[model samples]
Target: MILAELTIFPTSEGVSVSRYVKEAVKALEETGLKCESGAMSTTIEAPDLKSIFDAVERAHEAIVKMGAKRIHIDLHVDHRLD
Candidate 1:
């Protein structure tokens, strides 16, 4: 399993933060990733790196559709488990 911590900075818009977060969460879900928590930020759990990449790509697409001119995403993957 892989744990991904993502921080997304989307271009300024009039849309509500909740809406953006919802869209991001939905996109991740479509990639078969579990959205562990989502508010101003989101955390997702995936079975592998491919799923995580898929989720990230989907999230960027959603942000762009929402009128975001630019988006900065930081992802940290934890591959080792005790």
Candidate 2:
């Protein structure tokens, strides 16, 4: 199992980015992975690295589609074989 913490936002979007964050969450939810949203980041549980990456990509695309010129993504992953 893999647990990934993701923080995605637009650097060009100025101080307020709640709308973009909400779009990202919606995109992540569409991926069908388990997601827990927090104030700083969103935690996702997936079966493997590929799944996590794919979901993150979708989230990025969602934000891009919303007209963001520059996006920043912070991701931390925990992979456990046990």
Candidate 3:
């Protein structure tokens, strides 16, 4: 099992980027993974690293498509064999 914490936002969007954050959360949810949104970051659970990466990519793309030139992504992952 893989548990990841994703904090993604656009630096170029200036302050108050709730719109971009919404799109990122939407993208993550659309990946069909287990996602929980927090005040600071989002938690996602997946079966493998590939799924986590794919979800992150989707979220990044969503922010990019929203006209964000500079984006920041902070991802923390924990992979447990048990």
Q: For candidate 2, lDDT tens digit of each residue in 1-82?
A: 9999999999998999999999999999999999999999999999999999999999999999999999999999999998
Backbone clashes counted, model 3: 0
TM-score of 1: 0.78
Which of the two candidates, 1 or 3, achieves a greater TM-score against the reference? 3
State the C-alpha lDDT per candidate. Answer: 0.76, 0.98, 0.98
Worst 10 residues of 3 by lDDT: 7-16
**Residue 3 CA displacement from its true place in model 1, Å:** 0.7
Off by over 4 Å in 3: none
Model 1: worst 10 consecutive residues (lDDT sum): 9-18
TM-score of each: 0.78, 0.98, 0.98
Provide the global lDDT of candidate 3 against the true structure.
0.98
